[model samples]
Target chain A: MSIITENNDIEDIKIEGEYDGIIELDQWFDPKAENSVLLILNQRIKLDHSAFEALWNSYTIKICADGAANRLFDYYRDSDGKRYHPDVIAGDMDSIREDVLEYYEAIETTTVIKQNTQYSTDFTKSVNVATLLLLGIDLNAVEINEYDGIHKLYQQADKSQLKDIPLLILNGIDGRFDHTIHSMVQFYALRRQDPYFKMCFLTMSDMIILIPSSKKGYWLKLDKVKPLIGNCGLLPLAGPNIITKTKGLKWDVEDWPTSIESGNVSSSNRFVGENCLIACEESIVMSVELKWDKITQHLIDESE
Target chain B: MSIITENNDIEDIKIEGEYDGIIELDQWFDPKAENSVLLILNQRIKLDHSAFEALWNSYTIKICADGAANRLFDYYRDSDGKRYHPDVIAGDMDSIREDVLEYYEAIETTTVIKQNTQYSTDFTKSVNVATLLLLGIDLNAVEINEYDGIHKLYQQADKSQLKDIPLLILNGIDGRFDHTIHSMVQFYALRRQDPYFKMCFLTMSDMIILIPSSKKGYWLKLDKVKPLIGNCGLLPLAGPNIITKTKGLKWDVEDWPTSIESGNVSSSNRFVGENCLIACEESIVMSVELKWDKITQHLIDESE
Candidate 1:
């Protein structure tokens, strides 16, 4: 018996096998698709080299948000004695070290764009760059002197060409609580404006995906390559209480009423089956534990 | 001009002169009050020695949640050459190293309780133990052999004797995202059942507090000893959209309507004044960045 949605509409949103394309990066590589962009933020956490390399190889564009350039430089400097340059280096240029800035600027292939906008964050700037680049907007045509270059580029870009691109945001979580919350806010904001853009937040520990409540519901099929490591959670972080029904969980809920106030938020819940079906009354954040062993194995394979 | 809440009646919730007491631990010590408890969880982040020592000195009760005993033992093994034993070591015997467990057990002052309950988390078990211990319940009367010993003790404790003790939960964040969210759920659960209990989550970087909306509102005063390091944020994590009015921030909002869906959540905002006043239409999570310099200075003072 396969997992079914709350409304029993299993035929409509039944995500069978791995080809559903529901914004998950469990597979090692997507050679056919090259639209995904990996955005790196300036949080000082020991990023998994294997995970970084996997996303790097999978995605078409790699952009570093400010000081993340320094991190990338340092990461590769010690590991392989090779300078790993991002496709585009964009941010307010505050936290990026002077030497690191020079090193990246000296790289002929890297486009080091200094966006000194106080209104938006470095991560936002990187997202704007990703959108503009994905939309096939000419970098020289867009006015780069303005405070909101990305916003300007976004507004002028051909909307028809702006397809929903998967953005793998890295090092955004597990930082200071404020920054982590800010990233979450951005995640929700981007999803609300453009449902086409699939933004998946990747940390060392887990992968966070925003599961929107729709008439069709959603099916999350677990890939054999990326099995759930420890536990997963369905958090009702945003507005209103979340009434959810799930299948393929160790402790599956029929119609669990969850809210921050009611004290019934589901956390530390394990995935029991290969696939999970979620039917939510309201949009909620669902995160799956990332298996580090599989991720590191990929890294080893890449190095060999 | 001092910051005021949304309501014109500022007299009721005016937090003045750093003594308003809104569950902040900026000061090195609360010499007057010794009722607070420091609950250590098994998340393996490096605990700031100064911050840990400060909290240890401030609170009368120190309890380790399972594998946190291992952390405490490791932290003090090389330094001070003393086996700093917690008053109570509670939680399921899962992650606690065998050597570390034996070390704590050998200590005469520490009461090591093995709570092998699958229903409740280790942190929750520790909380139950804290509630029972703080209520002056006799430990001998409680059935230690049972899985739900703390829960049973909590049931039998005198209601009048129970006090709203501040619990400083350490290393709870930056681990598994599910565990972190679970800890946050517990934070709300404790607050809902008992308004008097003030649960403060402390990390290496920040202090998190939940401010509930009321006719009285809330006032959070900045302390000279505990100055804001980088930035502060007002986050609406759960329930309804938060309509907030604040002061003493770099970008003070008159009336900010923030929701997860709206994408207007305030994060990476700075504190501008000594005191900040908040009037919220709904409960919100507020966090302030901690100064590592001052914290390490406190540690230095202790060592000298």
Candidate 2:
């Protein structure tokens, strides 16, 4: 099965929609996928059990960045929740409450790793931790004191066996501006390191994914991802691009030249078809609105 | 006083910490500057009155993007509010409640503009509207049925008399991933069209500003920006760049290269000095933590 469909129309570079490279965003929750991982950042735990169950049901290796463990602690305490312990809690030990740390540490299955190095953020550290854990490394065997300790481990591992995997990040995209952009930068950076690993930064309403410049032709399966509210955008975060041809958008662009300085951007465009087609000369950031009512409709949707 | 300081060290184009080009972020609230304007987006109104008052004290023209009028309406109803009426309510007329629209329209100064055009976001339209009003054009004087209506008016006006102005945007930075990124794009776009205008996207906790590439050497007076919790970040949102040299960050990099694809980024860095010096080869986004205790300690701190 081919993963790309090439085209030459729409005043720039156009491609026909194909099912080969279908970005099935909803498939991240598959329990059978061993490559899938879940990482949480510090945003208040606001979703219902079903909201979490949808994410938790994925049954992936779970990790939290510092104080996110506190949020998880509170959510379990405040609601009639299925207490899901994270595989690892990692960060500078700044925001995580003492009581919460003790609670998660008491669990034999959960490991607490504190890296106080300020060179990278707790987020970058947590992401590094998740990537290594997914690579089948025993973090408990290593003494991780540096911010990039886990990162160094990943560098020495055999990447030859890895397949393209999904790292679903929760409550990570909508907080501080720098945190949000950094998340995107890491996506680009991580992909550069190992093309088999990609991240999906999620909030209750949307998910952010990158269509790497190396892969010019793309098909985004957003109907199941967003349903009726298919509000989407193709952000030129990596650099300027002369031809960004897209299909199935409410305001589809023919040959939009986008630059941060020139101000040619496509934000707030809605997905109008079952799938959207995108082709660009450079890497672009894509975000789509998410609807979980259907996902959790029958699967224990907790009313918050 | 020259706005740029030149330096030849740091393994890249370096700059001295000059008093010029000092971006005093605190001055947006001055009632004396006619160019300073306030714009509200569709985030829930959660700040204390002092929070709004700090922004309102800047006392520039106030306008809300579509449904933000509803949030302003609800905040007034739910809190110990002064009920500062917005001068204009503008957008696609979808999210704004009928009652809220009528409420603001009843006031003599407030105008309700319905521009259902999808080419631009309501934030973009509201910004266009703000820029026009700042340029001394009465919005009420024009028939604006299209998204770029206000933009057209500005293109026809005299630009020689205007000075570089500040547009303080509230509840905009942290939203949908695209919304957050789009706000930054407009800043770059607006600056491209008129070098005399700039925007500051403010949250209760932080503010985002662009250090334009055109000006290579710049000094950011961030002592007042972030007091004790000096959490800050310089994002490479516009494109790839080399040598984003800085002097005031806790882990300042020397001649660092930043790109979305390269994963080389500066996030979760903090200020350790009174002022931060920056010299970038291309446009980079900067965000800093905000401390309002000093601004609101005595100025009516309405706790939410």
Candidate 3:
């Protein structure tokens, strides 16, 4: 079966729904997959826990970005009065609640403390862990030091062992403006650092992921109409260049050069037709619509 | 004496407590100096006629950004059965109510019909009207058909015999993310199009305005600490390298290449000991704190 219909496999699970041009993966994916990392952050308190539990059932290794452990505990506790602990909780522990600290420590949730480091945000620290996890290093072999803040911790993550795991970031874009921009910066930074670690930012309404394309010719297929996931947009936000589009939904422009500052930018384009195909010469962040109903249903089906 | 404290061009006002650095402009300016622009869209229903009347007393003209007229009419009709009309109302008419439109037309408000335009937002149209008034152009003289779409309208605005005006934009930033982004885009575009047109965006808690700097130098004095205008952040959102230094901030940095992609943004910085000064090599967005208490006081004082 094609990956779109193969709901059993992890890749197939991310590619459910009827309409299939590009699967935004708005739904929760099985976390147990070899090429996956589950990260929870403090900002995601409103996130649906059942969806998270579904993801947790699939993803074994978890990294809580700073106060994310607090959110994880709070969300899980509110839902079922159960403590959902992460495999590793790391960041500058300033905003990390005191009760959460004690509880996580009691539950043997490995707390890697990185203090007074403003160079990177809490999300970066968790990202480093995911990167290290992708390298296949035993968690026991990584020794964190005293007086070493997040900078040093990230350094350790850099030098530590290897594997190629795909990182899925939830509740990343639906926050404050500065925070969202910071997360996007990290996304771009990760792309620069390693090509193996493919990441996707699953927003409440859309899925934003970077697809790096070379000068070589490539094509993407569209199979079915994914319900709820109605509109989609592909824009080159990183730099100043014209985007040459092959085919898309409603307003498909051929060889469109879009730079807001330098003038031409394709905003407010509609996704009407079947499968939309976007080919960019450089790496571009493509935002695809996610049908929330389809996402919830997929999660329910997976859990069942 | 700073322009903040050395006021009373119009007197009989009481200056109460010591402001820590927040510029509370309530009692300083008269109620009859400026016109009002109302914005009511989505869940944001923030406007009172008494407060608007104070602005109308000062302003020579008034314009509503699309659905703002709907809200204004609703308020007037709901309260005391009054049907106050505005000078002009312009937008895509997406969310505009039919009753509100008929009321405005009945009351003789110039209704600007703009459809199938995606370049400029409703707020931008209001700003354009403000520019027209400031430049001494008769609103009737301009050919309505000349302004095709919002994108083309802006091009026409660029060529129109216009005057430099200081525009006060209320409730621009605190909306939805896309709306806020559009506002920022408009800010940048306006700066690029005209140097004389000044804009000040009024938020609930803060007054944000872009101050374009000279390459060589520009000086700002911080004498009086305007009460509610406590903290301020200078964001270099424009895509260019900028060097900046400040004498009055708590943690000041010199020659900071502040760019969104670079991630060297200066946020949550404080105003230290008084009389602070910021010198930027390029244009920057400066956000200052606001005091609604002072605004209310000013309105009450005007009544007396």
Candidate 4:
């Protein structure tokens, strides 16, 4: 079962043995693809004006997590000196400035979703909005609740047509460590609940993919990303995993017994080739250090 | 099972019912008590000079993880302008600068344990050194191995006498998101294996306590911390936990279910009072955002 979205531009990776599922990690969040729904969960996005501008323009739909709307207002501006606003602003209206809200409200294209509920985080609310919008469910058409809009929205939506929608989240994994860990846990839980949403957390330091457990473990295509990342890691997020096999890692392990219970994990593992396969009994998170310089250069070249 | 040291300064928190265990969060790393092993994990320790001095002077022993030695070398210089040197430096030695290593090495008191092994992280190796040292077993006395010294040291030392040792870690939770999560996971696993090391991860933003799975749950005395923190979170780090009960949170939950598998969690909870009681079926990590301004003010007052 391939989770990859019919993307096979690269040649099929030659594995000695068979695999269960295919996860095209690098290709899914490619900047050029411009397919991901961008969510700014923070004002701490370290991207320069050009990079932020490029990133903002690449995504089809952009959403801000409450106060992040203020960050977007401050971080980037058009050549005409006007601020770039997100398509939708969703949160519990506690942190965002009123002036900023009015600024976006004035724009007819921007929708301000004031969901004042502690049951879900601003991030979750934003994701819900993105999922609904991506599914072509008009906010005006949906019977939305002030709290837990997804519950109401899920009931009315066509569940069968739900395909994997890529989400490029910024500053989602920073701020508090527990918040960062919580973000990971949320992805795991949310992914299980709605398999249609695929998360790719991007920070200045690194990028993370929460690889859910599969009976047939994942074959990762790293061809496009081999040069962009530094040291990578295959970590157990929710539970322990019995790693049966791996390929193309700097220090490849076979039949490796991994347990969060025992503190045994594969961290700081480098990507030595263009392809890799992970055969594990349970879910594990994979991370690769971003060569920000390289990414910035690529973005610069793209603009040229 | 009271995990707190014998030092009980305030009144014993009275719960209406019964409890199985006690975890004193606020008092464990009490600066006045000044009994801890301070470890610099990165240069990102945001403590100002007086604050750093106060923190450094509080701990009995200090250790740095590899490149962090350089961070220490650069971060704190005495009134004499002499660089601050840790008692021990431990890691794979890949990131540490040669000059910084030599500077620490020249100090007759500083011992650099260059374990070329990747089996355990530098942070783990530093913990091993701290544990062995805290247990009064000298590095010279222990039958040490270049690779996996903890295995050899554990064999030589009497494990029964290993009481709970408080560790004050800085820059331990920042930098990469995975490293932050990995650090938390390590504490969970390490604490389970060796219940003696009480972890207090103090970064600029927050402090995290990895509460292990207790048969009776935990009673967190948040008395002293009520004024020093902004918002707190009861996050599921390793796996899911059925949160049966909680007290002292602004929005308390009863018979609440928590699952990393499903993303159900208690985040951004406020400290309503001075004490908290959490009843959970599985392991859970709790965090409180530090009021850095207040802390800095307190440090200034203390210095005065």
Candidate 5:
């Protein structure tokens, strides 16, 4: 289910998948529907069966980031239930159980094994897999799937097709602190690679992510942001840098200097109303609060 | 019922309280008894009650930070439960429920209410209580009851009575991202306020906090550490500020310039063997894995 609320010609579109909640639907939030493809990571932080099912049902092309396939299978164990598996289960087989691996293969969930690479974490491998899948490259044709082949995998993969696809990374943050930071690093890294690639991080409570560039007409609108002043932050994760200009917060900034691990940080800031505006020089992650129930209803209403 | 281990020197240490398993203890992780008090935050993170109870029953004094008192009361509904109501409940009372206030008052737990004070968060108020409690001050006195009268309470309290008592801070991290970050910010803020206030943050899975000064010769003996190589990271949170470090992990350095937001970071690093020596010029929050079972046993065994 998709919630596309159009005010002035596609102002905001909220996609309702398996997860339920009222998400922020704004121009700054939407990904280009044309080029990019959705990629699901192996880590599952606060995801249940229903939400996982939504992502499974919505996207036609899915790739599991290593042990994520195992987590998905283990979390939902109804053998006769609506078993929606990913299109490809690829990663190092360290955490992936043998039984789980065979189960997916038996059900035709293509398992791509990349055994010999330790330098790159499972997440990077998953990104490589998504790159290859988006490029429409056949994995069977590749003779060796080694760590060295990963750089080539990205090179041979279609880079142009990566833009504009709504990539929903699951269980990235809110698990291991290191992993969460790694996910944020990937956010900035990917933004540099494909500015049009639509990305949203689905944590247990809310969707936390980065906005690439600050433009004059950029604004964010949402439906009923209750608990409006819980805990929201604008982190300059890109190191000792400052952010200028903003609207819709108790401590809104105007060209104020901020940076991660140092400098002025905007924390314990309150969201004033249903709509907000934030403009930054480089992409910075903005964490917001939303109820999952509202998110589901918004999508249903939009699709209707 | 505290754990008195074979190697432990002290006794009568207790963790008598009802709590979720979200609060954990591992002897192999935290063997040091630096701060005597454990300040619990009200945030709804994964709390390991059993571990906390073990710690509380052993310690002579315990205090709850605002909503944390509510969480304790909620977790330990059974009156006969070993966990006692905290010695004091301190905070702004903006978030603490009215019913919770009445219940704790009936139980005779002292409530130090701080109103019209945005200068500090609730967690800080709780920390102040712990500090006052450690000094052996009776909080009920007229002079001590006032908001800024914390100094009066501390001055009258005996410092020699609880000189080496270590403070274990629970539910600080691992909740919402912003709150967790705010807790860290508090750590920096407090370190500046008083460099001698020894504190340790007990996160859900492991310990992620700072060692005020390396002066006490704080070193992790490897034989005391299990789950040795989990996803660990040591970043200079107050960066633009570089950190000087010594010993342990793959990237061992003395004054390494570490602040890699997008590219390089000390991630997937391991605790190489029997002991790790680390010291920072400024206070640094170090996230380390814990062997819960061992720590729990240590907490219980030490009280024996």
Candidate 6:
């Protein structure tokens, strides 16, 4: 069945048939999917239990970034008494509580690596750890005592063995504004260096994903994912000015001049159809509103 | 006593003497200042009592944007049974509760205007209301039944009577990403039309202000304002790629190229001296950390 609609400038495409050579963007967290990794940053905002559980079930690997260990410890303390240990607890160890560190040390499930370098953030350190782990690097062989341990691990990993893995970063946004922006910068940096590293930041309110300029006719299948409540935005947050053409939006634009300055840019545009196509001249930040009740309902359905 | 330090590329400038023709960016809220205005948006986060009180004491006019009236209502419900009425309650009456509308109606102190226009957001509506109110436009003289009532008031407002007022927007950030970005877009739009409308978004964590590209040798006097906790960031959130030079930051850059994309952009950079100088090739978002305890202490001092 198709529900296509056409106006003067806007066209709604209902995604049904399979397309050739389409790169499916991992914007949703499916409980059955195992290709994604979860990286938790420092405790900026409280994680919703249902959302966290859903994410925990979907990801293959989970790593805590420095002080994030304390947050994780507190989260799992009262529930089942069984520690939901992460594969790695990595960062400069500045904000990580001593007791929490000892708890992780006592329970040999988590490897705590202290990267004391001030040049890079703890979140970056965690990303490096995930990169090394994905590349099948032998953790023991890598020097864990050094300040740049993750960097060493990255160097030792076989270049051919590296695979593109999707990462879902939690506590990434809604914190200190600088920290949040740094995370976005890392997203741009990592993707530019390695095109395969697909990442999304999950905040308490929304999910932020980068729609790269390389994908000219990018089709976003909204019906395939969980339902969102309100409107989404195409944010020209970084880089140069971008000219965009969009379909399936309430106020769809053709050859729209969008930049960070005064007159242009689409901020409160809403998706009107099941599928949307976004053609951008440059990469920009696109965020979808997260319906918390719908996510919780999905978890309930999965359990049943 | 000046403490100017230099490394290979980084330089720290100790602000000792005042410079000529410098516009002091209203990045900090002083309880003593009476020329500021506070505009409250829809309730995304709880307003800290101390912070709110401090802001309440500082600003000359207080306006509530649509659903923010509900938040203001709840905030004053249990405390001393005294109502904190706003000068204007403006927005599309979609999200505003019926009880809130009636309560304001019962108490004739607040003017509730129903702007049913979907073209502009509640924030923008509130801004328009503030503009009209500032111009001494008698509400009785203007027709308030129409959808674009405030816009009409603006048209009737004498051009010579318009004043550039500083605004402090509360609950403006850290909510839905689309809403936050829209607020920012409005900031750019408002300022472009009138160079005098200085505005800042005050969240629970940080204060966001735009360092316009027009101001080349912009020197930020950090010591004159309330003390911030830690570092600040120069976010190239909007606009084209920018080349920047700075003094008085922990990692000050000299003629550094910054953009929204990969390798550049200064995020998580810290202020190292009492005053900082930023010479930006283009306008960028600058955020400074908020010291909650210090703000609360100031409130306590005022009370004593």
Largest TM-score belongs to which candidate? Answer: 6
What is candidate 5's lDDT per residue for B20-41, written digit by digit as tens?
1111223323434544566778
Give the TM-score ranking, best first: 6, 1, 4, 2, 5, 3
Model 4 CA deviation exceeding 4 Å by range = A1-21, A28-34, A137-154, A253-257, A302-304, B1-21, B28-34, B137-151, B253-256, B300-304
Chain A superposition TM-score per model: 0.85, 0.83, 0.78, 0.88, 0.76, 0.87
lDDT of 1 at A138: 62
Compute the lDDT of residue B118 as modeled in candidate 6.
78
Q: Residues B122-145, candidate 4, lDDT per residue (tens digit)?
A: 887888778777777677555667
For model 5, what is the error of residue B52's alpha carbon versus the real structure, in angstroms, after optimal superposition?
2.1
Q: After superposition, how far is residue B69 of candidate 1 from its true place, in Å?
A: 1.5
For candidate 2, the per-residue lDDT at A94 reads 96
Error of 6 at B45 (Å): 4.8
lDDT of 2 by residue, B119-224 (tens): 6678767877776777777777868646556656756777777776777788876667677777887777777666776678877667788886633467775433
Q: Which ten residues in a row have the lowest lDDT in candidate 6 chain A?
A: A1-10
Docking class of 3: incorrect
Q: TM per model?
A: 0.88, 0.85, 0.71, 0.87, 0.80, 0.90
Q: How many Å off is the CA of B231 in candidate 2?
A: 1.6
Can you write out model 1's per-residue Cα lDDT over B166-256, one digit (the tens) per residue? Answer: 7778888888777777777776788765555677787877878777674344566555543436677888877555454665566667556
Q: What is the C-alpha lDDT of each candidate?
A: 0.70, 0.70, 0.55, 0.72, 0.57, 0.70
Off by over 4 Å in 6: A1-12, A16-27, A31-34, A78-80, A159-164, A224-229, B1-28, B31-34, B78-80, B155-164, B224-226, B241-243, B300-304
What residue pairs clash in candidate 2, if any at all? B29-B58, B164-B196
Clashing pairs in 1: none
Q: Model 2 lDDT vs. the true structure?
A: 0.70
lDDT of 5 by residue, A1-304 (tens): 2121212312223322222112244311232244334455655535544545544555546777778777777676575763547767766768777887778778744756564577667776776666676677776667644654765667665576454566777777666665666677777677766554456776655667675555441355554433322557876655544455555566667767665433256766755655556666666776665456655543333333
Note the B-chain TM-score for every model: 0.84, 0.83, 0.72, 0.88, 0.75, 0.86
State the lDDT of candidate 2 residue by residue for A1-304, as single tens digits: 1121223322222336342355666655443466677888888876777668667766467889999998888776435644678999998889999888888888999999888777667877787777788777888887764555765775677777777677878876767767777778777777766667667876766778877653345777653344435567888888887545566666777556877667777776776666667777776778877665665563343222
Worst 10 residues of 2 chain A by lDDT: A1-10
Model 4, residue A160: displacement in angstroms? 3.4
True contacts kept of each: 0.82, 0.88, 0.05, 0.53, 0.23, 0.75
